[model samples]
Target: MISIATALLCTLVIRSVVSVRGDEECDASAAYSSSGGKICASERGDGYGSHDVIRGEDRMIPIWWNYDIDQLFEDHFDCGQIIYGYDDGHPDDDHDDDYVDGLDDQAVKEQHIKISDPVSETELEKLRYQWEILREKYVREVNIVPIFHEVKLDSATETTGVDGKGGFVDRPRTHGVSAIVVPTRIGDAGPTKGRGVFATAPITKGALVINLDNGSTGLFKVGHSWREFAVSLPREVACNFIEWSWVQTVPPSSVIDEDIRNGLSIFIAFDESNLMNSADWDDVEANVRCGFPPKHEGDDWGPCRFHYHATRDIAAGEELLLNYGDFEEISQQGWVDIGL
Candidate 1:
């Protein structure tokens, strides 16, 4: 059930276009409505299931997760299911030995290869090769699919002190900001102890902020046992674009604070860690010094830079910020050190 407070928070944050039940024109000035039909100037809900109403399909935006090369292998094979190769009656098919013992040993080795430790690069490449073959064989049998959800805007206007309408008027080309409304701190917020939103302009009350690319939906499971997903940007260039757009939109008053300006810097930091961790470096370099090191100077760095939205306008007392860069790191570091 959605609380009245949550509903009001949503209305004030997103600056949704007010729709009269049967009216064609949206009334921007009309009092915000609740699920119960009560017209109130302030944000309120009946504490029923209105939370869903305030944050439902109308507000949901779609994002995609392009499977990483390794993820593709784990998804199809390591999920407790066999995805490749089949049993051949002749056990010594690939070896010169044709005896029963040799054939049995080959079968055992093949089973180990199928259900052993983490998939190796060679194994992943082989899987990809096999997948391609299977894909061709069952092009019509395979289905392309998408996961959908009604995620709340990560940077809501109330949270950022921006009016929704003002954002549209000022930055027509950019989407507004939204806040991460998760029950618990996740991503960079969990580790850094602080969280914020991203935008191209000063966000306005009632405007919508799309959690595009690395914003929120970038989460993915590592393995069956691990529930937390690392924070990451789709590409390094996309990170620069988000950072650049934010830096371009700041007001002179807020730009002088180094801490605020650098706050967005953590986005890059978390992304870097995500990139490293995703490669499964720990196991690969178990015995070699050439692999990723245990610790580095950049590891403990904090995000102190602040970047403003290009054309968005903000009000006073908003939490002024960006999304947490990575969740695993944030959860490990605790929330306090993230912003400072």
Candidate 2:
């Protein structure tokens, strides 16, 4: 086991490798923010507030944003497969042949995977401290997650964004409409002016409502940071990450940024998730829930995912109202840098 003294020493040394912020493409793990040259500074109020280490087995990470990836793909094609981050192995390494975790045909092969328990409370706290102070500089940015739907399209909607071919297009493009929730503006119905997410039909409780893909609908098992484009990101990206998101912390990704402890926040830069209104806790319209499959889930292990599920039987016309805590407005008391 690593000694505590050695670990503390390592933390300072890791932080010393900060990269000067610039408009150039960021390495994600090595890039630091401007001003004090930290990943994010609450004192400077970079819009990313409170590096408070709130720990949980599946704690929410309001960290970075990931969008504007169309340029990465050589061509825009049908990512026909269910959107998910492949683990260290084949894309389907996390599930068996009968089913690709929960994706019916998405898994590439069948295999047995070991099961691991969720991070224990004690272990979580220990990790929280180590990652926060000693973590490498990088913000796991989650700008958009594609919404994969099973229900049929009720309207004349078809795939938008890229040519529906292959490869990537860019941010703000669409894979199509999600069968899970529909975006319909409910003007001043209650306390919101944004579009409300409603059910396409009667959705069963406990159903897998979302898959959490960054360019698609919601963010998946990726850790991001505001590196290359912090100062130049689109306004939509700003609203999703810093303005209307519940940032969650990322555990050490052994496969990706093992040395970097990043936080992740997910929401569409331009979708209904950015507009889902808040409701009372006892009478929630929907719940922004996420889960991680066991070790058996391998590549499918969602370190963190943004999934909105129905808390109760919701009617078709009823707007999806999530309990955004005691006062959704109170969370933004110190919104001096919310530029979006």
Candidate 3:
């Protein structure tokens, strides 16, 4: 197993993949580029090879976005044969013969996958997360961003205290104690902008909001198929890990061994600190900054600890933002001189 500590030593390099919807490329300079990065379907073709399945007039939605597992599975049943990849070890075998093939309405189901009775909500969420990871990998390999339906804003209005005079707003719920989530105007324009970190109470300048020390469990997992590893874990374990982890689809060139470059890494931050969003360094609203704990004379081997602090005094409801400046440079230089 590649140690997360060793992986961290390899600086991060981020590669930009141009997003195209149909024939034209997404305009990076457009006003809506940063606003959730969505593009419209072109009248010519939607480009997913299944153009016949989806009309040009309809909004392009990723195949995995649907929540109904049975329907979703039926729609992309062929993917199951590819993803599951069941084989009986025949060198010259053509496995496609095992299943009946025809149009969706005409094909007869020949294979069955069993599901547990009374599927729990957590299990369903895990399935969704796993499905998303699989589809994301597929799309990246093909170099296209699947157009997704706009996420619906939370339907419930912000709750208020008994005073009824803009008394209170429900804070973002979390299992840890670093920061709380609050609504902010940082995303696509809709009924709600998006969720961001907020101070549950007053915080003084330079105060630490959260501390991350991943020496114990190395913050990264390097592999070719992280999805298989994730899904193979016990139900609850896989669910929690996937819910909190972020996948770096393309790894830095510093770690660019032929095999490693093709593979990806999964980063896990074992705290709510992972929720902190990015902002520009000069942005007045960028209140949070990441720092490292001071090294003592004898603590030469202490694991890298990431400390997040307030740049200025922050009010109870003010959003916390960090400037995630050139991560590739930071990773390329290694964490020893991370100035952010």
Candidate 4:
């Protein structure tokens, strides 16, 4: 039997030789143990033997690192496939199908996969920031303006006539009439006297008069005697009369009246008793006659007054003529002009 001391020395020598050989001859037939016995080659067992030192660099890596690498490859490189065990026969060989199956099996065995909890605060904040950016990029805001038209009557005509009794009249009269009156003078200075009247002649039967606000264009009735025209409010002075007031109301109505002999009759009305009492009829007449006051005040007439009369017999297609004063006065009159 070998002595204990000699056996110990031999063991040390064998260990040194194996270390120097590295892994080159681990499986070679010439490899020997300290006793000069051939080293026995053992097949790697079901991954649980003491003799099984993991074969490659994969074995040297931490389990977590290996798992991360596998996951990355699976998610980004492989087309839904997994690479499994490395081949001993061919170092470069890769096993796709088996690898994926192995990974799945390992995951199941270890219970490593599970649904995570709710999104963290950081993630939610990111989402909100993105939403605000989108809102600012697309949001918008706007103000709208309106349009109007002007109408005029031709003064160059022989139709002017005098009523046998007193006042002046126009010829070619019509049963129903409509007209727009403008101020005779317009400027930055005080009010002026020169006003003009535009008459829509040849009034048609069943014609309807339309009232519109400064913001909108008036719509005309079909087959109406007057040509459809746009009307605009005066630009210079604010006409409080045009402002819609709950106190000043007019019933929707129309009227047909004849000229009083040769004298033209015009009507005006007001809300305040004192204002109407202070107005001058003669002044109103002079303005209408000579085209002085362009726009008439509602107070110009007491309660209600006929400011102008038709000069001639008005036909169905003729538009009635009136001074601007008449228009403002009537607005405040609040009487619905259902033709008498």
Which is the leading candidate under TM-score?
2
Using Cα atoms with residue i matched to residue i, what is each candidate's TM-score against the true structure? 0.18, 0.34, 0.32, 0.16
176-287 per-residue lDDT for model 2 (tens digits): 3332343343222232232345555665554555443333333322212222233223222222233333334444556576422244322322233544556652354344
lDDT of each prediction vs. the true structure? 0.24, 0.31, 0.35, 0.23
Q: Model 2 TM-score?
A: 0.34
Each candidate: how many clashes?
58, 34, 2, 39
When summed lDDT is taken over every stretch of 10 residues in candidate 4, the lowest stretch is 223-232
Summing lDDT over every window of 10 consecutive residues in candidate 2, give the lowest-scoring window. Answer: 71-80
RMSD of 2: 21.1
lDDT of 1 by residue, 28-80 (tens): 55443322222213221121111112222355210111222233223211211
Q: What is the alpha-carbon lDDT of model 1 when measured against the actual structure?
A: 0.24
When 2 and 4 are scored with TM-score, the better candidate is: 2
Ten residues in a row with the worst lDDT in model 3?
A: 110-119
Report how far off residue 239 is in candidate 2 (Å).
4.7
Put down candidate 4 lDDT per residue, 234-323, tens digits, no spaces.
Answer: 110001111111112222223543322111111211111001110132233222211112234442332112223232343533223333
Most lDDT-accurate candidate: 3
Model with the higher TM-score, candidate 3 or 4: 3
TM-score of 3: 0.32
Give the Å shift of residue 233 in candidate 3.
7.5
Q: What C-alpha lDDT, on a 0 to 100 scale, does residue 96 get in candidate 3?
A: 38
- Model 3, range 1-340, lDDT digits (tens) per residue? 3234432432222233233444455565522222132333223211212221211223433322221222222232222322212223322221234443432433233221111111223223333333333333333332122212122334366331111121234422112122222222211111121224556678877676654332211133332233333333333333434444543333333444443322333444433344455665234556766553334544432221245566678887666777654122334232122211
